[model samples]
Target: MRVTLYLRCRGIAPGTVDLVSTGLKTDHRGILVFTLPDNHPETLRLGTNDLTALNPEGRVPILLLPDGRKMTQSGPIIDLIESTLAPDDDITLLPTDPWIRAEVQRIMWIIAADTQPYQNIPFIIQAMGEWGMVKDNPTRHPLRLHFIRREFGAIENLLTRCAGKFAVGDSVTLADCFLVPQIRNALLAEIDLPSEFPILSTVWNNLLDVPAIRAVLDDAGGIVQPLVYDAEQFEVYNG
Candidate 1:
């Protein structure tokens, strides 16, 4: 099946959701990726684009299915990918056991719902403006750090009970897809993961070694690029 993903170009500060989508593509393969302009999301927010037509929320990581349907929001998009996987597929983003599945979802949500949204660029830009602070204000670092550290701390504590080589187990799951990117964000914020959250640090290190995860990082030059598509120029990977 052909799938098209719309996302932003991978740069110094990559989008969190974009990484999740890219990680999935690395595992699932046969996905066509289109890199969007960096300003694409800002255009939607500034009333300059019709991105809302595809996604009411105006977010990236929009997945266009082969059947001409579109899926938005990373969590639901991940769900769609998991649902469509054949039983014999080599990679299982979501585990089969009920308890393990819940554990996986738990980590995914902590990053997706609790961590990423709060520290996202758009939100941080607006927040700094509201406080009448300059873009490079020293205080801004703490704001981003607070959210990352808080969430990482909680996940660290949980990891003691659930983690193995990865977030929840030895194999990569949806949680790791959601996690590695967040760890990148933390590093961008200057938070020392190994120093603060040892368990997460170990998992982050292990995740980097996985081929799917490593390829995603290497392809983006240590981050992830967005998906913007042109019918003629799209690249297809059938992993």
Candidate 2:
């Protein structure tokens, strides 16, 4: 069966999440990946474009399934992929042990729920301009760092207990798919992973060597460049 994955640049969290998740599985060889260039005409038209019909949120990483169904949101999309795999599949993103599975989800949620949303570019713009939050004019605002640091601190502590090589164990799991991208975001935000969160830093460093993670990073263009939001341009699409 063929699957179509709609993604944006690696800088975007959801895209990176799906990219890493799909790359990890050997059964996904038939998947076709399409990446929208940053600020492309099609991308600028997201909210009103044909794409909006597929996902009203106007987000990337929409997985078009073979049966003419589409799925969105990184967590659910990853879960769907995991669900389809054979129980004895040599490559699994989730562990079979119930308690270990819970640990994986715990770390994944720390990044997915507590961290990424608060640091999203549009949210940062609205927080500062519309909500009257204090503005620190960095590529990623201080407000973004506030959430990143807070959640990453929690992840770091948890890693000290559950982590072996990856986020949960020596094998790569769903948590690592959520993790490596957030660490990329934190690094882009100028967080010193090694100094502030050493365990997470080690996990991030170790993941870099994994073939699947490396493939996603290579496809995503090595290190992520800081996102630059043009207010006038944003208005054209979001208005």
Candidate 3:
């Protein structure tokens, strides 16, 4: 059964891109596309303010299996992909060793749960609107930056132990999957990753050549450029 994955293109949904690209790399049958027309409820299944109330599992990157089963949330989707792999498959985004997998999850979570949400543009814009603040208000961006950088700091320390060619000991793992997109976000936000986190910059540069990573990114029009918003000319995506 060919799977269908609905993803967001405009803002930073790196986790979705990561898992889908991983699925593609592992030779999973799937069609990956964007949620166009912005916030149309069908695609954006999670309600604007009450996602937990709607579906705590999450709302984007909805995957439809050929058997008519629906899947949501990046984590479980990734788990499904890994579980379906054949015994001989050479691609494994996770390590076999127990300790290493745990380490990989540690780094991945720092980005997935800790850092990425603050920069979700649609949520931020919606919050700004609800607060009756101008969308372009300078006060908004810094707040997200603060949290993102703090998480990045923690990731930096974690990577120091296991990072090699990728986020964990010379192989691309789930950690790498989560890492690249957040770095892409950092770049979009003009965070100066090269200056702030040279080790991460090296890992990211190395990731570009990986076939699956490159394919998904190329499909998305290369490295994500920030979608500009609010008349201030700050780069961002249309939400």
TM-score ranking, best first: 2, 1, 3
Name the lDDT value of residue 236 in candidate 2: 43
Give a tens-digit lDDT track for model 1, residues 16-82: 3333232121112222222233355444445544455556776566776655577887777756754
Q: Runs in model 2 with CA error above 4 Å? A: 1-48, 225-228, 231-239
By lDDT, rank the candidates, best first: 2, 1, 3
Among all candidates shown, the one with the greatest lDDT: 2
Candidate 3 Cα errors over 4 Å, as ranges? 1-58, 132-140, 226-239
Instruction: Please give, for residues 102-164, the per-residue lDDT of candidate 3 as tens digits.
Output: 998898778778877777654555555456544553323665678778988888777788889
- Cα TM-score per model: 0.70, 0.75, 0.69
What is the RMSD, in Å, between candidate 3 and the native fold over all Cα? Answer: 9.8
Cα deviation of 225, candidate 2, in Å: 4.9
RMSD of 1: 12.1
- Between prediction 1 and prediction 2, the one with superior TM-score is 2
| Minimal lDDT window, size 10, model 2 | 1-10
Query: lDDT scores for all predictions?
Result: 0.62, 0.65, 0.59
